[model samples]
Target: MGLLIDGEWSTQWYDTKSTGGKFKRSAAAFRNWVTQDGSAGPSGEGGFEAESGRYHLYVSLACPWAHRTLIFRKLKDLTDHIDVTVVDAKMPDEHGWTIPEGADPVNNAETMWQVYVAAKSDYTGRVTVPVLWDKKRNTIVSNESAEIIRMFNSAFNDITGNTDDYYPEELHDEINEVNERVYHTVNNGVYKSGFATTQEAYDEAVTELFDSLEWLEDKLGKQKYLAGDQLTEADWRLFTTLVRFDPVYHGHFKCNIKRIADYPNISRLVHELVAVPNVKDTIDMDHIKTHYYWSHTSINPHRIVPKGPLIEF
Candidate 1:
């Protein structure tokens, strides 16, 4: 709902006017990766070694992007190795993500923007969550949820003694292919549909969203997971969005042409993922609903959080 301009917090809604009523998401400002041996993996500088007590994660339960990192943490058995600070679900317009005093034990800041300022005094951009902070360096290792989950997948394997590889080398091509489609169409498609200010933008986004959903349904019908028989990073990435479909994206985001329940394969995948140990515990429906309905005053002026549309998964 707000962003940081030169390290200063300013309350402003998404400017769809510039994009012809389309909601264009900004790229993550921090892109440093955490590797096992303090060496660079893909982007940014190195020296961020994966140590047991060297990193802290900041997340919001409501955010699907952040949810992906949480899922990876649970699946990769990095819960005990990496600590976390979850921001409040009610993101006030004045302050982006309310942390309150002492909520973030790592930074001890009241708002998320302050944490960004801590890393870089003149930082400018949207203050998003699932920030992987390196306590040893006292700077953010990575704010990109995709890269952060990758770090959790393998970086801390030696420390935790859990070598579950979600992004297997053999499945890289297939996983990337599925991720590209899901990221543009389904993962970010709901946001594009809900935040569109014009009919054209809404129609275009929703059309692609459902089309991809149908494609996913057909894909899952043949294979056990998105990539193949083994559950890979692609499945977890899409899991966050599919799990939130009925609860938040359906009515709240106006992605109601068809519910996830209507797609048997997709619905089965959602349930199967949630049934994974500790996976269901990562989800907080109240937080998810409150954040979307109460925060987006542009969508619902009254800020009345709906009580119905009971979801089973």
Candidate 2:
């Protein structure tokens, strides 16, 4: 809910007034990558080689973007190789995303912003999660979860020996295509609907969101997963959003045109994904509910967290 301006932390919500009441998300500032041979990744500098116990992941369990990387890390069997530090669920006031006392172990820092400041003295931008920190380099390898998951999918294959490719060579084109649509219309759509300041913007966002859901329902009805029969990265990417829809977004974010349960196919798909071996362990309902309700003061002024609609399926 806050941002860094010229490396200084400032508590400010999104200025929807400028965008005609439309909520616009800031692009992630850090886009570095981790490669097998310490070579340069797609965007940032290299020297981040694939080594066991050399990298630590910093994430918010509440964030869907961060959740994707956690799923990838678990699916890739990198749990033993890479370490993790999770921030507290409730991010309040000017102190955005602080690790309450014993929660953070890596730097023992109070705020998540400290990690950014540690990475670059004068960095500026929204401090988001799923930051891949290189222990040896003493810097963040990447803060972009989308790219971070890709790195986890393949970059450290040699070290981990878990080559169950989610983004396979043959299905790359299809997976990318699905990912593009899902990211825009569904993944980010819920946020657009929730944070919209104007009725027009909210209506537009909700329409697009449900439309995409209908499309997904149709697509999933035919195939087993998003990209096809083989469960691809695209499926997991969308799963995070879908899993949270009914529980948090539906009521908390006012995205209640219809629940995920209303769409039988989508609901079934989510349940299937959640049933996946290590996938269930990645989901923390307490974190998901608490973070969304408590973090956004603009949305919920009193910061009163809800405790109903107990999820059964």
Candidate 3:
């Protein structure tokens, strides 16, 4: 809920009033890409070669965006190759995302914003997590989770020797189609509903969210995953949101029309995804709950994090 203005850290919240109560998320500023051959990726400059132990990831387990990158890191067998440092569960007023005692690793900076400053002296914008840090270059490879996951999906294939392409050439159209709908109505929809300043915005966001969930439920009833039978990136993308729905979004975000458990297909699909080795390890409900409730003072002024609704998955 804070941003850097001319490299100075300032505690600030989104001004939803300017957009008539709609929470408009700003586009990510860092658009660098990690290509297989150190060539220029889809955006940014080249020379970002894919090498083992060259990159380190900074993530908040609570963040679904960050969660995706962690999932890819494990699925791609890049755990030993790339290192990760997680922020503490609670984000205090003074330190936005600090490393608790004995938790500091990587750069051991006082705050996550410090990492941004380290990368770019005059960096400005929201200091978000899921930062892909390049140890070799001593800079960030990318802060945008979407692109970072893509990098994890295929960038270090030679090192890991895992060529499982989630974004296959033949399925690009299908994956893009699914990603577009899920990103708008489900992935970001929960945020829209939770951060909505107007009744109309909340209603619209909630409606689309449930509609997408229903569609997903029906789709899962027929197919095993989002993109046909094979498990693709779309399913994992949706899994991060679904895993958090019942535990956090249902009550915390006011997305309680129905829990994922109510939709048997989604519930089962979620459990299956969680069953994947190391996938469940990536989830930390403590961090997930603390980050959303404590961080968003606008939504929960009391800042009281919930404890009930024990989820089996």
Scored by CA lDDT, what does every candidate get?
0.92, 0.88, 0.88
Error of 2 at 279 (Å): 1.0
Model 1 reaches what TM-score against the true structure? 0.98
Q: Which candidate leads the pack in lDDT? A: 1
TM-score of each: 0.98, 0.97, 0.96
Expressed as tens digits, the lDDT of each residue in 1-313 for candidate 3 is 6888888998877888888888778888888889899999999999899988888898889889999999999999999998888888778765577766545466778688998999998998988888998887888889898899899889899889999898988888888899999999999999999889999999999999999999999998998888888888898999999888888899888999999889999888899999999999999888898888887776788999888679888
Off by over 4 Å in 1: none
Q: Worst ten-residue run, lDDT, model 2?
A: 99-108
Of the candidates numbered 2 and 3, which has the greater lDDT value? 2
Give the per-residue lDDT digits (tens) of candidate 2, residues 150-186. Answer: 9999998998888999989999999999888888878
Deviation (Å) of 240 in candidate 2: 0.7
Best-fitting candidate, scored by TM-score: 1
Clash number for every model? 0, 0, 0
Per-residue lDDT of 292 in model 2: 90
Badly placed stretches (over 4 Å) of model 3 are: 101-104
Error of 3 at 191 (Å): 0.3
Supply the TM-score for candidate 3.
Answer: 0.96
